[model samples]
Target: MSMREVDPPRPSPARVYDYLLGGRHNSKVDRDAAERVMRLWPVRELALANRRFLIAAVRRLTREFGVRQFIDIGSGLPTEQNVHQVAAPDSRVLYVDNDALVVAEGGNLLDGRQAGYIEGDLRDPHRIITHPETSRLIDPTVPTALMIIGMMHYITDADDPAGIIRDLMVHLAPGSFLVVSTATDTLPDEMRQAIDMYYRNPAAPLVWRSRETVERFFDGLEPVSPGLTAVEKWTDSEAAAGPWLVIAGMARKP
Candidate 1:
């Protein structure tokens, strides 16, 4: 499809997240919705914390693991300091998301030779990781970091998110890492329900996982330092309302 078809000058996950993170690349609808969600927690730190967690995860993978490739599943709209920017510059990142607007908006931020965008849904990581275009950009033989940042809550348990992570991990090399973060219900029940109810207005059906349930996605991997902690607590002060109650972690294969 043409760029217009993909972007459509519309609202999307990427746009909504951009608004959440205080970026300028979003539509009015996105901004309004994002504001409503943040109101559920009554603080802007929620978005900043999520972005910080993502940056830390990417740097660790790039510097410590010497990883040069990434497959960011549910990769939303690209903002400043995106995965490619934080990764080794030589890194080739294949971003997959169902949002055509995300592919459109984020696609323009990259030189397709190094950073590639594919229009694919989260439930279809198989097709995304194994797609012909991704094969051309990513060398599966080398270890890759599969990122599932801040997007899993949109999926239901019936979809078997744990199985999805396992299947994706099975396709990677031994040294590969999976970096993930998702919303959890760590706040007062009313606040958690408030945020969930707000997000219900969006295109995806969000299912906030508990800390225990979130751990299930890391089934066979080695948990990195500060394992399975709240996204903000992993490296920040999430003292207020658990700062939106999101869980995040990095795990290595083998």
Candidate 2:
């Protein structure tokens, strides 16, 4: 699949996110939807902060933890400094997204690269874990980093997000890592209005959680340093003042 195969008429969260990140894979509809959200809040800044956190997390995992494989669930359209690009050349990355448009665009962008993209939803952890592409690229016996950045908020409580995380963790090695970031309910009224605008779109709905609830997802895993802080504050590189809309954390399976 390629950029030409992307569904331009339908606005997807991934495409809108790509637009927010200043990537070229988004359509006019995506740009319009992104603009609507940005008008109500600093969504562009938040998204950039999230991206920076992802890069920092990847570098830390690869350089410090010596992790060599990554499974980026809900990875949107590939942009500059992707997971594979940030990790060592020997590292293997499997990018997964529920959006077909994202899969197509990512496939095109990752062509000739060692990374692989697969179309899969987060709700079904087994399907993604057992998929041929995933199995072939990732070794379950070795420590792997499972990244769920900026996407878990879409999984409503009804979907049992904690259960989903536990299910996926069961398949990983004991030393594997879980990296995640999700929107918190602790937002200003204006940002709450922006979330409302996001709900108006047909894309995946959000289920904002509090800091406590988000931390629950890391149950049984040991949190890394400076546990569960704002995305910009996760590392020293991009620290800044904030109405910190989202919380991020990384934990290791013990």
Candidate 3:
């Protein structure tokens, strides 16, 4: 009898993140990836902290800036307090990612009832910006909060992440906002190396940037108070000073 081929299920980085947030949508493959990151970054707190930043940023955008529309690119599995969940009571959100597992699992979790999900790459902003389905939720003429959390590193100078950001920002109105975060190297090099190695196992590895490199993503935007800073420090009443591998900030299109 011929043996059946067993193709490894290479779960998405998004699914791995879902595991870290205590969601059940992740596969064993994703679990392995999360474990690798938790071990390498040497600061398990970074993951938790990053989530907290997302919450705070969203709240401020909704309550303070009156942003009722969102396009959360690279949103992982539908973990508790997802962007639509947090912003939904009032805001309409459209999530975009190309991971099949993420679309399948998140579909099961959200049931496509609350906010819409589209399987597309953020690198392809033109399609996302102009897609008819997305147009239903996000009107380019209105203000929106574009959440690009923890996904920029996957894109490089060759991919033009900075340019991607600029194009998206130009389409938003003055009140529209952008909350972005990426891995940094303020922590020990060993920690960064280990954390990156986890993603390195896949077809492509993540490339962490320096603070200045990340700041470039917000070049033309009017920065919110506290400016671009560490993830745990962006607009925090009492910022925690630590050598973490993540940096974050919020800015307006002006």
TM-scores for the candidates: 0.88, 0.93, 0.88
By lDDT rank, best first, the candidates go 2, 1, 3
**Candidate 2 segments whose C-alpha is farther than 4 A from its true place:** 1-4, 199-204, 237-243
Residue 44, candidate 2: how far off, in angstroms? 0.5
| Residue-wise C-alpha lDDT for candidate 1, range 25-91, written one tens digit per residue | 7767677767776766653566677888889999988888899989998887767677987888888
Best by the lDDT measure? 2
lDDT (10s digit) by residue, model 3, range 206-225: 77788888888988788997
Off by over 4 Å in 3: 1-8, 111-114, 201-203, 241-244
Error of 1 at 35 (Å): 3.0
In candidate 3, how many clashes are counted? 0
lDDT of 2 by residue, 120-216 (tens): 9899999999999998899999999999999887798989999999999999998999999988888787886776675544455667788889889
Q: List the residue pairs that clash in candidate 1.
A: 14-77
| lDDT for position 154 in model 2 | 79
